[model samples]
Target: MFRVLGALTGTGGPAKLDQEEQSEKILSQAHDFEVALQAMDYVLDDHPGKGLQLLEGSGAKPKNEEDQCVRVLARGVIEFLEATLGFEASVMKKAAATLSEAQQLSAKRRQQFQKMGLKTSSLYPPGTEYAVTFAEACLLHALLMLFSESMVESAKALFKLRKAYHMLREILNDINAAKKKKGSAMYAQGNNESFASFVSADSSTFKSVDIPYSLSTEEQQNKELMELAENVYNMRKKRLEGAHIGNSPAIERLRTDLGIQALKDLPKKKEAKKPVTLSKAEIDKDQATIDEFIHSGVNLCFGILQVVLSLIPPAIGAVLSVVGFHGSREEGLRLVWRSTKDRNIHGGIGLLGLLFYYDGPFQFTDVDFDVPATSDGLKKTSSNDLDNSTLLHPGKMLEDALLQARALFPNSALWLLQEARMLSSRGRLQEAVDLMDSIDVSGIEMKQVRALMIFDRAMTLVHLHEFERAAEDLLSLLDINEWSHALYTYFAGCCYLENYRMCQMGLMEYSRIDFFKERATTLIFDAPNMLSRKKFMSKNLPLDRFMLRKVEQFKKFQSQLQLQDPLDAIGVSPVHELTYFYNGYNRMTEDCLKLSHKLLTEYHNPTIDAKEPNQELVKNLLTSLTSRRLGKVQEGCDMLDKNVLPQIITLQPDGKVKYIKKTEDPWAYPTALYERALFTWKLKGLDGLEECKMWLTRAQDYADDYELSARIGMKIKAAIDRLEG
Candidate 1:
């Protein structure tokens, strides 16, 4: 345990000058990879073209096996980012290919190291030849990348995913075995001297030297990687198990196959086996280390556990009714409190997790989990109030973690950023802003971490409705963040529009607006309040000049306070517009269909907009209604039959149109039938009346238990009466 844990603290042997130079070279390569990762994040998050250029320019040819492994990983990540941002199948294919290369490279490295009889029990520094664990991480990451991007319906993808899971299970088992081995007296005693000797030896000489040691201390990173893997799986699983998408057959088959394969893969031994048992003391020590690792904030386990609990829902009582654990609020809170007791990374992370959990009020019921009806009988538990005397509040936890953890990781921007996030998550936006303002970023060395902190601050400001201030931050961020320029520019435009809205509503005082202007000047180290410039709104910014016409139109509407729907404001992104339309349609607002039509006609830029949550069906329905209002009876009938009615018609493999069940096409089926009934009444001859009644009857038949169906039925009856008269 000491061997494994000490590796995490960077305690290793002094290297020769030549070895140190090699280490330096490896560090430089690793640093390049890390920088590329950060740039990828920005590009994926913000969609800036410059980020892609930075990523492309940063690529360097590999000179060694280690460098080659890093190169593969970098290529995989870059391709993954491209696939995500572009949503292009070609990009996804490229990602799949790059990641496959990475996996092969990683596997080759692992085999090479294993053949050389490299000890896995002792701890090694990052740049050492013994750090084959990084290759394992690369392979795991590649597999996950493919799994995430690949279609679940594809049998080949499912097979690959199953293999990935199998690999992950094997890796974890090995790490656990290594942990157990290092814990034993034989491996633990006198291992430090062996490790020092192993590290000091030249790479060529070290492989041939038979070091008497257990596989060195790679267990800490193994545990961390396992946590990451679990977290990624759980997050993706949660999405699949959503009400709108439940119980994927592909995933289920993969899980079952993996389980069966695991059983089959176990070795059969003919020799008599002795049952070995541990003493109570030994058992306690093992449990202590496991517990410490589980709760360690350095890993993603805490986040994973929180997400798993959220998915379980409060009604379930215990998460899958597992032994020794309940899914109640008390159990969740208790788990959080246990981790918070630590003065290191875990404490800070636990506090942050607690804030999100507790911010939902008495119980953590914010996330919409697809909880089963059978869970109603389970015992309920309520979270303690924020002001409860016994419970530790989020505010106190953040304050403590900052003061306590500082002694260890004093220059950590993560801690400060998390603190700010906690405050923002709890709606203490001003306080969060002030805390961030106090952070002296000059002391932070990592440029990526510093940029991330600033980005977080900018987002927090946006949440606080300080759009002008947020815009300034975004503009500054855009200057440095080439990857996310488009995203930042888009947000900057949003901020301008929002600030304009505030001005129209008299929400922004002149002094506050002036204060924002002063901050913008100060960002470039200029004289504060010296430049009497134009008020920085979306319309005035020189950025994204192509959007000038749209901004100008929005400003005209803003001055007259004529933009009835903020969503309808011209300068707003199409993404926001779609969200507005979706919300309005769900609520069955009077102008929703018309609003959607206006958006579809005006600002639906195919080049820039994401193709999802399509509103064309709603627009067609509106057109059908409009034709009926204009007394174009035949046109209305034809529109309903052709455009509006087909939504509920699922085609069979044989090309026959099949009527979907109410459960399958919930909103579409009943609504389409009702529309069909209305349009049939407008058709020529008395047979039209009979056809109208038949369609209305079908609508009623499918919608018997639905409340909205009753309203549709009443309207259908009224139309039938008018036709019969």
Candidate 2:
């Protein structure tokens, strides 16, 4: 660390200078590329929705690495520079015209791609961060190549320009030395005549790279090994240069050679050598498995210790502490950090510490602990503090707990389940699942225990918006054969939402919907009081309002789901979830109006009051409803279209809108589609009207429901009728 740090700070040896300069050349090339790309990006930005949109005709094809590099390297940098440079009116006009045309052109890509029935987002590997990197790297290569040749070639001219260029060259010298010392692959492969590049703006790239090695044939190995070695050497060389570390010939040579002199030193086994060979992937998996066991053991042990220490005798705890049974002061601190994780280690550690020390004692007893039934072992967690210096470290804490618990109960699922919950809370979802998978919940209603785990996991999935998985888990839980209206209703509502989304996304399955809805209704009607007596506030906030709204929505949707032939027909309702939402909206409005009306007389309209806040939105929706009730559908709709919709887009579910009031827009959320449909109905050349179905599809980005589908379907029918007439 010191050597690397010193070299970086200019205290490195002269030999390191060459490697450092080479790295500097690379870095300089990257900067130049940035400046250049920034310019192009500015041009692109000026024309917002424009550019290389020719999709079906031809995808973006930067034939070689250089072209790809330059394209990406010169992206946002120049654009940002231009933003600072005062854009003129003419420039703005030109940009607008260009972007307008670009947008029009770009639509074709989406159109053709959609017709083929594939996800555009999935065209690139989901969440891959490749495109930006490779492009920049390519550009860096080109820029450095250009600069290096230019510097060595233009060394004389640069000497005349100023001392700044010389200083830059010297800095590059130092950087190059460091890169060579470390043995960069890029540097080894990089021609002294050329520079470097790789700048891409696209989030992902799927370019295939040659695997670099094949031990299948000795002949193939001989040929590929050299290339692979070169690649490795180049990367090492560049890494050293970038860090400004002093160049070391020995290091470079060492990188080039094997432990022994001859090729015999290299392992003879191929990837799957029957006797001993292991692939990198296999090795990684083995290591991970080992780590999992260690983590699990440590956690369980710590949990046992925490419980045991809590019950320790004061004198013994103090004597043990002084005698270093736990660890030295530093060791203790470090162990505390490792132990604070969800080790399910609670009860005794801090209490023991407090008992031992008369002075201010450790506050382990103050730490929050939960004893829960789960698939993983028990978990005792620390709050959000990352240091783990607190009682939350799971390592020792969990280790202690397991030790103590096993002594008392031998083997208990109840304790292990708590462990699983702890793992889930710490973002170790898969780990928690694995831990649960190892459990045997037999004889003691293990199915229900497993079901609970499924529920917890489903909750997490829901948070991540993995609705499909969450729905599946929830359904599994319902299938367990469960009871209670509130529980089943909630699951039913969630299931319906999932199905609605699936249906909207071109899914034609009806049986799935029927099954979920049936389950939901059965659970919902099991107890009438389930809907009324439940307290909505989950964690302090009176969520009763929101929960009620959700329940009301589902109930309404269920009521509207009157099938013509319950036994023979498809049970999927056209607007089940939507019916619920609309129903919920009505219920919430009813409550809101009551509050608003009371305020209208006493508080003279809505004012800022935390306790009894304003209900302007409710009042407005009421007014709209009144107008609609008084035979003003068209008028109310217009008011909703022009006024309410935009505001609702920003309205909080629980918090009322401060500036806007009311629900004049009966079809507020679907206004975008409604207008598009209406425009088509009027024979107006609405923007993207031909792609109305696509617009509807985009609307289902978050979730789906029968209400929206019905509205859209109705609009389509109305437009068809008007067009035919």
Candidate 3:
């Protein structure tokens, strides 16, 4: 592929790279590639063992969903690729059959011309004339539409090897350009907040200063390093026979062609391809890593993808890196997967692995997930409470955050958590949960903040209807040493209460509801702001009125300025506010279809800019939202696609989507289950009616569960009608 790219360069490629050899640069490039090769260097690296035991001494485990996601992704990629290739593990035999049939035909190697396909044989008479055509080549490009994926083995390696080099160059260029424009833009010392972090700030050091010469030199060096990697990679690409299982040679070539010497002193050349400038918005949305991976996968640069993708499973990481398959990843993976031996083979299995696991890398855990900021945010005034708001920071802290969230690195967990919540809400729960779970929470000092984390989980689970499982989340949490966070106590109480309620609902018994309510009152007193929250609320539970009552109560609470835990206090609140804004926009689309109007007045959300919630729900949301949106009625059902139903439950990890976070988050459990249920309800048809009847009783396990009732109610009714029929 490197060679092909080199050939394409055609006298106008890689100028800076044409320059000198420095031992320092060579060592750096080698170090980078070694890291890039972790996923692909299976030859040198031992297979990572599975299970908690292996991870006992290994720090944190990959987590259930992350591990499952990779395996699933490997499987899915294989399936799609096989289907596209018109073969599975045994397609070679079929192709061979055609070759044999071509030999037996006497009409100059033609096989029944009009009915069958292809024209190739050595048995026809020498002078015999048979029409030859290249018609199929047209579709070969289209063939790339199938079986290609970022998860393909080849796709991954190319990505890591090339992408890392590309990103470094890009970052260096940006730094250099920033320095040239602003002056004194170097990273060394004093910039860090902690004095200790300075590691002894030296007056002569490069810290707290930026120099153009140093910046430009850094970019110049990076440019050369990346080009070198691209060149060597392309060199091996030109020799590819086809995309399937046989594309192993190029990987070996990638490993061998670019040695330490080649990286040392390479020649300068012309522009490889004119660089395209993009806006900040565009860059933020671009999944360059994913795009490259897909490209490698489809180009039969399978050896490349295999290596890069090995760093992280494509199923879980593809979306994070690229964004989507149809536009970018599909072509890339298809180019390689379709060209492969078969899906059933090791290669095929690898491809399928790409498909199923890319989105998840997360799984269902016994926990509660909630977002109190959601309820709180709903109560804020129209004057934009995020600005100059003390609910979060004190004095100058608010000022600093305002300057940061809008910038590149916010250094705020709220921002990260908000991102996590949005992903979970979209139904990539596993990914969201994985990210939240992995977050470093030591920086958090507020007890209320800790509770909010628990709330995030409780809400996710409530939506999922994992009644007993959701309730169990509070047990361990309540028993923990640091269970003092107000948000934590509230959510844990909610989870237990909701779980018991769900059990009652499931059993259709009024007694359990009463018992759980009694249990809930006892736990509420333990909440951080329990007395304040219940000061004057109605005696009747809010769940009775659904989301409406909760919305009204929060609104009242906000109006009085009687709130203890400010809405924006957690740092992540503003980000959560953004999510609320988007949901408001999505609601309008829901209004168009009249999906949910049971809440208060028909409020139009200004955030979505009045755009439709799109033609369809996102893949992450599809499975989770389907049952509630589609319903069992035939007329209402016409809006659904049969194939989509199965696809929804197909179980994608957060690893499949572009905007997803790289680590685990606590809010994903319910989100994943909700989506799984969407798929399940649609496929179950008549059986869902039973599940619907018990939804409300089960929803009561949580303190602020008004929203859960609505979600479950919608799905249950729709499910019962569809499945029970």
| Best prediction by lDDT | 1
> How many clashes (backbone N, Cα, C below 3 Å) per candidate?
15, 122, 128
Better of 1 and 2 by lDDT: 1
Instruction: Please give the lDDT score at residue 651 for candidate 1.
Output: 49
Over 4 Å off in model 2, which ranges? 1-410, 426-431, 440-454, 460-485, 507-546, 553-725
lDDT of predicted model 2: 0.31
lDDT of 2 by residue, 564-627 (tens): 3221111222122222222211222333333323322233211212112112333333344434
The clash number for model 2 is 122
Output the TM-score of candidate 2: 0.24
Which parts of model 1 have CA positions greater than 4 angstroms off? Answer: 1-106, 112-119, 122-136, 139-164, 173-406, 440-445, 510-725
Candidate 2 residue-wise lDDT at 42: 21
